[model samples]
Target: MQTQGHDLVSTLDERTSNIRATIENVLVLPLSRHPSPRSVLIIGCGIVGAATAFFLARRGVDVTIIEREGPASAATGAADGAVSVASKRPGPMMVAALSGVALYRELLGDGTLTDLFKPRSTFVVAASDAECAVLEAHAGALRGEGVAVEMLAHETLIARFPALSSNVRMGAEVKGDGHAIGYRIVNRLLSLSGVTVLRGVEAYHLVEAADGRIVAVATSRGELSADAVVIAAGNGAPTLLNCDGVMKPRKGQLLVTERAPALNASMPGSIMSGRYLLSKGSQKGAEVSARGYGLVVDPLVTGQFLIGGTREDSDARQTNDLEAVRHILTDAVAMVPGLADIRLLRAFAGVRTAVIDGLPLVGRLPGRNNLFVAAGFEGDGICLGPVMGQAIAAMACGETPSLDLSSFDPARFTSLEVAA
Candidate 1:
């Protein structure tokens, strides 16, 4: 695939050069540029931070990523890596998802990061009438954006996925959505030229000057100075920020199944509940009310089934909650009957940094010129990683983001009056 894409790029370049006279006749605007930062300190080496470092390094910016543990050891290491556009909300989120998919496709063509991505179909099964209604609404909204969404009736869905429960009323299928290997992506990005990966060094606090620009960072190992800093520390951001309203931790528990003949077979990308889809922007009425379950069964290249997860409000780092694990497994079995025979392999948990608003804090910090943030992605960090990285690099380089960032402003939580 990499060779094929490269050949296409070369062929296109050659052909375009053949028509150089016509190309020269076309008008083009001067590209805007920014003074590159002398150095950038990224405070996490998860998927988000690693990708951010990769993008910044690609632009000739010096980037040092400091991780308390090894790269992708946090949420990125634990996530199921479902890169599904169907999982995202409509409008801005849909646009971001599409852009993120495109970026991943481009990366897939490089072979350097090929192990991190794979194409798979995704399905959303509806178990009840209410769920069916929600799926209809979701499919309708997605189709309006020209996204391919097929709504399958009960008989068709059951025939296609015999492992599904007979109670399923319908299912929504999205063809282009797929899964990626999160840890592999982290490794690939960390191997880039200009990225310096430092582990076992916990960043404790941001050292701000009188002018309110972050000048240095105080870590357990030592203090490091950089021209700019990005706080991509996932759930650990609140401790680093020490700001009451910046962000909070939301815990999610997941369980994995040992590879079995039934489970090892090729499966769709992922299946999300309608409740989960509509719960994005607003959490007020979106709380999982009934049994509170959303199960995503992702089949990895290694033949293991990555089944998950349950959302909780507590910030505890507990990974072995037998009850929560059982709930997740129970819900998963209900969604995919074949999963019932699979033996439980392991269970774990991770905390996602969630802000009051659904959007992530992806730009420069308010009042702190040199301090930038790309946290508060909740559980969707994997789906949004590449795009967020590109956007953060643009902000660090003083270039305008391709998308309007007002909706994700960190100031929405930390106001001048409140900070004062």
Candidate 2:
């Protein structure tokens, strides 16, 4: 790794140059002419921020993270931990999801994420005729995208997984999906990185140099100086970036059941309803409503079942309404009759930041050379957080990211008036 004050004026690699050239809509601003950063300040301690700090620390850079609360106290601690590509549409997000999952595999192999990631298949089932049609088309799309898929008829589905209810007409097994608890990953990354975290501190604004570089941050405690800054605070990012109105908070409710080893072992992997395709707008011609209900019954390694949830536009993280809970449980029981016998252990809700355009805001913030942003991933954050962090850390060090990040560039939003 290069030292501080090192000049970074190397030509782009052939692959990177081709990707940059293909990106037509983004502003394509040049990296700062200043030397590479010696110190980096991360504005969130969630999974994304933690992962960023981890990569930066690995590169021998001084990294410090500031969080409004304890690590993973917000969305990261409350997520379902599904590192899945089965629910993604075939677009930039899908491409990113594939890369994200691949990174998870790499981290697992390198022991950075040992026992933190659990690889498995996701079985999606359809109970009604309409859902069956959607399931078939979705399965075809997944195969077209080179995703390993197997269509299961009613008999084969029930025989292979007797835990499912008789209502399931058909199913599709999506391979290469996995699950990991969000808070666990955050803690592991922070521990491995050995970076200091300022809990209970909040950043209010960015301080800029005369040459339009972000040199410091104004926070509740005081002003902290750094060579570079990254805003990964989800919804909290819009205000600090001074780029409001681009992202909004979306809420989801989930439930956990008591140990049911017999039922859990009967299934080979997590079960997703065909409706999830429509809810996520993965099915062609499907519209994503403000409030959508999708079912996913995940069997945890602890012999418990994790069931979820409703996607509501409002940001009500502290409360789970009775209507949503009842509907989710009803759907779960309908899909798996044995679930009706298990006792409910807990019900919780989380608020995730979602951009209006669906894609997350990553890479350098437009017009702010030393500033970067990686937030608004919505539900995909758990899957994409680490990879996006790796990309941001590379950018902060004046290197081209391995993945094509032009699609997620913050410069795509013209109305974003970011003031230093």
Candidate 3:
């Protein structure tokens, strides 16, 4: 077993000359202007913050992104870039996902996102009876919402995807979903937005007026007086806002294979498991797993296969979990035996903030009207980041958001607010 793992890594490096980098480090394209922002101090430079700055800049809002690190250095950088609705459990999460999917199409339609976006047919496969039932119900829910979904039975699953093993019992294909590299989207959005990015700075405290309106932020760099403050910091947002235990960091791992177009007809789109279903939130449709060892196979546009992951709730920055890698490999090989033959280029890991209820915080705090937060995406940040940014930006400009934010109110988890 040890020899096989060594061989897999060694063979891939020899075969592929160049493979794209994952989430820890995002490429920064040099920009000419660094505008002064008297409007809003947006903390965190990940996808959510960057997107907020992106749309806000378009609306002529003076926005500044203060980051402890560079852009896409958190969950946004480490994600598989799945703009998928298939993984979301039915209800509010699914509703936001549909809107997010539509928003991504609009972004792609414009010249904003070029070769970065590509259409994918998402396939959700299940190994057990429990998992299959969940997949079916998921397909039904999506269909009811006008999402294009088709169920593939055992025979059809094998016929369409010969790479999968005989044990594969069922599968469902989700249409109209697409894929994008997380870092690419963040880097491109920042480059195009031209917002002031203050890297290597930390937001220490959020200052507010006597009337409870947001005023300024005391940071490591200096005092940043702002008309408003939008906090898009991932796991760090809770700590800064004194809402610590509410948003916890959930770590994930993924392995990327070398360019192998022959790997399951280029693997079409992402292959998910019903096990993936259980992690989103409380769903009675079927019990998958809270930490879904669910398998996701993404065929990259560059002809690589991105397979992931294990969900661990810890703040430890260690991304390489040997045990998690083993489970991921075993799951990948069982579903698609062809994956065993392919060489693995590298394994990537990152942490995402997960809300216990499995929904992101996207609106204003109960008390601080001028303070807004967009965090706790847990792995869904890539899909919802753009729309969340657009919505938050509109709010900062004193305009109503385009999408319904009744579900993502930050006060839901607050004892006082919830009691009220």
In model 3, the runs with Cα more than 4 Å from the true position are 1-38, 280-282, 285-292, 415-420
lDDT per residue, candidate 3, 1-420, as tens digits? 112234433433332211112111222222212232236778999989999987876665556778998898888888888998878777887888889888888988886787888878889888898887778888898898789998998999888877778888998999989888888999888777666777898988876655766566777865666566788999888777676567777778889989887774646677887777765442553432435566788888778889988777643474686877889999888888888888989998888888867789988878766678898898788999999999998876667888999899887877422110
> lDDT scores for all predictions?
0.71, 0.84, 0.76
Tens digit of per-residue lDDT, candidate 1, span 100-121? 7777888788665666788777
**lDDT pick, better of 2 and 3:** 2
Per-candidate RMSD, Å: 9.1, 8.1, 11.2
Q: Model 2 TM-score?
A: 0.91
Q: How does candidate 3 fare on TM-score?
A: 0.87
- Candidate of highest lDDT: 2
Q: What TM-score fits each model? A: 0.85, 0.91, 0.87
> Which ten residues in a row are the worst by lDDT in model 3?
15-24
Best model per TM-score: 2
